[model samples]
Target: MTTFYTVIDWLMVFGYWLLIAGVTLRILMKRRAVPSSMAWLLVIYILPLVGIVAYLSFGELHLGRRRAERAKAMWPSTASRLNKLKESRRIFATEYSPVARPLFQLCDRRQGIDGVKGNQLQLFTTTDETLKALIRDIGLARHNIDMVFYIWQPGGLIDQVAESLMAAARRGVHCRLMLDSAGSLQFFRSSYPSMMRRAGIKVVEALKVNLLRVFLRRMDLRQHRKVVLVDNYIAYTGSMNMVDPRYFKQDAGVGQWIDLMARMEGPVATTIGIVYACDWEIETGKRIFPPPPDVNIMPCEQESGHTIQVIASGPGFPEELIHQALLTAVYSAREQLIMSTPYFVPSDDLLHAICTAALRGVKVSIIVPRGNDSTMVRWASRAFFSELLEAGVNIYQFTGGLLHTKSVLVDGQLSLIGTVNLDMRSLWLNFEITLVIDDDGFGSDLACVQEDYIARSTLLNAKEWQKRPFWHRLLERLFYFFSPFL
Candidate 1:
């Protein structure tokens, strides 16, 4: 009995030393933000074994060598082949408006394009309409159809898309489907990929997570982009996944999700296609050249002049430029800034920019779901609401449904739309695409959508929030401590 007691005591002492050595190595070898490093250390101090295991599994980003190599390989081709676009001098003739210039210039410097001119965007507010438009475009494919969806669950409107892809493939219009391995796991295990394969549609699953893969890559890192291009003329983006939102989070009790998608034409369509091509190349190591010169490029209308630029960010990029871009947009806003997203765990930089925007009288309003799919994320976001509300940013809780639209409107003139949620997963862990548009006409159209959402949302009362139960505040802050990882 005495020997057993001594052995256990020694084991505890050994584990304590081990924890210290591991943390020392992590601090010296791993390059992480100070807050993140401190957060991990705190976890280690509180729950030694659990924290070490968690840090080992989730700490270092290892999305595999192919992920790093794919970005390196694709950029040169992107630079040389697609960079030669002869953007018309009409838009550039007049300097970007003061409100938009900083944001546009930031984007232009980070991504290699000023907004592609002569573009048109058709916005869809519901899942049924978005899928209808997507199926319609897939049906019209002549040259090829390219699709990359993070979540491709098999049901609802997914069959329509599947049928369209199979039909397009059968008719010799090439079809390529790429779905994230984790997000689309059940789809891969189901008959969807097999059916598409049998029908001649090339299918690739991005970043499969497995026991062996845990060491080879960051298991949670995802490709959360949703893209579809038909021939070389039309493209679609924004928050709508292929599945119907009515069933998207049905189990979460959030009724039909309110989402938005933008169907694009003209040069922007080709730009979207090129962006898709980069992802396809990354996943399959096959290059998709800018189409044969014989294929016609859709030109925007002569009278209407709108422009869009595609910004894709993920583990592949050298830096998280998407985070900086959002910050720039917020900081550049002068009049009104209305933003909507499902999840809202923002980084320090984003949080500061938003608070500063509101404090400086930008009339900042952020609309989010009253209830969300993830309880953890909801709690973390709740902690920030108090700070933001105190800083003058109006927090609107949507009573209508889960607001899944991720868009930023600056001075009621520029609109940004895509898969990026205002959260850490979007900023660091997932591959995301955001479309930046500089046009008042389109902004007004998008504003009507935002206005409709605002009508359905309730402005949060700051004093009421402050009066919430002590337990509620404690739970929210506890979850918020994990925001960097969330």
Candidate 2:
């Protein structure tokens, strides 16, 4: 019996070493960012089996072989469809300002979708206003309505949007709704999905979670994009989910969640529609050739409209395109930079870019919610504040509510607004979409919104912030150390 126990112990020791060796080899071969690679190695060596299990479940950057292949297969048709829009909506290299050209080229050269001119944009700052706008648009839809959201809490104004969608479906307008499986698990369990389906609305869940398929893909890589398209002419995108702040997360004591949405009209709406179609096809295995821009339906004044580029970022797309683009914007900012987001855990490169921008005399300001839903994210975000304050970057904590708007404005002329948050998950893991607008008119409007947030926020003092309890500082450092995984 003693000899048999000794053999079992030796075998277990051998198995542990084997895991260490194999995981180390695989990490090196993967060629991830140096910081991420080093962090994973530390976790593996220190935490033992738990770290290996975490890495195996989440370290990989795959979307499952089948989903990846489906996305690859659809690329040709998607590219072809984009090309068909060139003669009508595409802008030449010389049409936009020089400041916008580099960022535009980064996405255009990689994704083959250039900036489309003559896009009319309306920024909605309140939840009730945005929902009303969506319902009004859905009411007018004659052909089709495609909507996607990360969270779909069914209550208050959200149910009104649903009733509007159902009415549209009954009126013979084809409507398809896509919800993230994990984010909207509550809604899925409710009767809303079945209710919509019975009303002739096609409902699909994106990135469905299955425990048996855990080895095939990362279960937490969610579809975090919020998009709504009506008749391929009017589209909406932003950080706002399909939820009423009055009814969502009220118990968290963060106050009402404030959000912003951009309602768009013109040719660029078709571009946003393409994003929805790609996501829909990847999940449903159905090819959809979205109709081209209907000039008669949503006419544009080419000389005065906004130049907008839609960046749909995810696993199959170019890695860190939005992150790099944002960094470039920060580096190019000669006058000022303003940013707002609920989550603000930036990557090393992004953090450096922001601090450098401030060090170089550009007025850099970041607005974030004082009360965050995720303790880890809040701590990880504050971990970088000391460095930022030292470099003259101003941090403002909004006291009104949870500021959920995700936007970046540079030089009062260029603005980026959409689902991309300033965090590792948004920068690397989740599927996100962003709109790069190069119009002084739209940028001015967005700047006003940021200014309002600043007015309502209390500026963080460097000395006061540094006077926090030692344990608070320690906790922040600990979370920052593992922010890559967060």
179-291 per-residue lDDT for model 1 (tens digits): 99889887888988888899999999987778776767788888899998887778888997778675566788877788899998766776677778788787788898756
Q: Which prediction has the highest TM-score against the true structure? A: 2
Output the number of the lDDT-best candidate.
2
Q: How accurate is candidate 1 locally (lDDT)?
A: 0.82
The window of 10 residues in a row where model 2 has the poorest summed lDDT is 87-96
Q: What TM-score does each of the candidates earn? A: 0.93, 0.97
State, as a TM-score between 0 and 1, how close model 1 is to the true structure: 0.93
lDDT of model 2, residue 283: 84
**RMSD, candidate 1, Å:** 2.9
Expressed as tens digits, the lDDT of each residue in 345-416 for candidate 2 is 998899999999999999999999999999899998999999999999999999899999999999988889
- Model 1 CA lDDT for position 125: 92
